[model samples]
Target: MKNIPFISALFTPALIIIILSGCSRIYYAPTTQNVPLLTEQNELRIAAGISGGEEYEAVNIEVAYSPVKYVGIMLNSFHAAENSDSLFTNPVRYKGNLTEAGIGFYYPLATYYTAEVYAGYGKGTAQYPWSFDTIAPLKFDRFFVQFSAGMKRKYFEIALSDRFSYVHYTNIEEMYKIEAFSNYKYVPKNNQLYIFQEPALTMRAGLEAIKFQMQYQICIPFSGPTLGYSSYNFNLGIMLTPSVFFK
Candidate 1:
């Protein structure tokens, strides 16, 4: 929990504003990074979590399975939505979803340490309100490569992961008007590509079969001007390893 305070400080004010005032010009929202510290074959990990920050709140589902020796696969899905009904003055809403899958290699570094790398593709849509009645729907495709390493024990685990992504926005309709609501003046055009670097810290504690999990992640734009993207994300939930029960 050493990074919790620093992460909270980075986005607390902005989070408060988004929660209280609501936003109508958000461009990108981050999902939880899945880091399963698999140390052996035939291991299965499933996690369900809720993530919130910036302009959207999301539900994240992740599955990781090691079907063979030194090989693993992962699937992830996310759905996010938010509205401004509480504000009463600015009635806006945002919605988005994404799904991705990847296959990679994993290996044990020592008796208690493991590492993995994965590359995947995903697609989703984000709807941002331009006015009380007008909504702009944008679609995007994503390609990403991620690396993770961590230590695993019977009661607790900690991991660090970094994901590099290329996002291309498509089907942009009436996106230019976002400048009127948000700080940026330039809007992303159709098929415009943006690169991002996302780093996350993940922790799990409890029993070996099931554990409480929490993660904090930050997104950094690498190639494009800062559009209205969620700067950070926080997730909390539970993780299950059914194989532990069989053993």
Candidate 2:
């Protein structure tokens, strides 16, 4: 739990994908507003991501587009939480890969809502006892698809997100499978199990020279219901983004 503060330092704030076109008016059509849609006209960008706070660490890969009206994809590799016979049982060094492919569309003058759809695929493994035993590790497969409607504003957008995930392995790859509360995702590498191992939320904010995409959020089970953490998955990293902020 001490890592919470360390992760807090990295937790700069909400990620803002600010559309700096600087239109004086708040309500205007994208055609007139000169919006930064993910169309062919956008500058293509590559991105990398790092995540995990007192729980798990994850790496993400994505392609950022400014030219397209609203369309892009994100690929991710989520590491399972490490097991813990001790405070940290060599923390489960598990990896699951996922890909998100979707589109953003709207009416000629509509704002604050866009049609969205996406699909994903992932796989990972761990020892029967959440250890890297020489014996064959247990494996799991996952995939999900959702037809969602997303809100769109210059500052932020909150959407009603609904997603369903599946986990497989007869011997139970995740400890959760062995626990009382049954979660959709495997136990990850950590013995700790919680529902919505990876909950889904959608929001984005912009910083001085960077933009953030709030892909999903998790209420830190360790903390009170109020004191929870969110996961900002699958977005651009500062090191690789182009310097279009000032221009």
- Which numbered prediction scores highest in TM-score against the true structure? 1
Give lDDT tens digits, candidate 2, residues 196-222.
Answer: 233445455564234565444432232
- Report the C-alpha lDDT of model 1 over 1-247, residue by residue, as the tens digit: 9999999998997775555334344577778988988877899999999999775789999999998988989999999887345553246667889999988999899988999999899988877774578777788888999999999999999999999988888876566654344443445656568888999999999999999999999999989765667888899999999988765
Off by over 4 Å in 2: 1-48, 53-55, 64-74, 83-88, 91-109, 127-136, 153-160, 170-199, 207-209, 215-247
Worst 10 residues of 2 by lDDT: 25-34
Model 1, position 95, has a per-residue lDDT of 84
The deviation in Å at residue 103 for candidate 1 is 1.1
Candidate 1 clash pair list? none
For candidate 2, the TM-score is 0.46
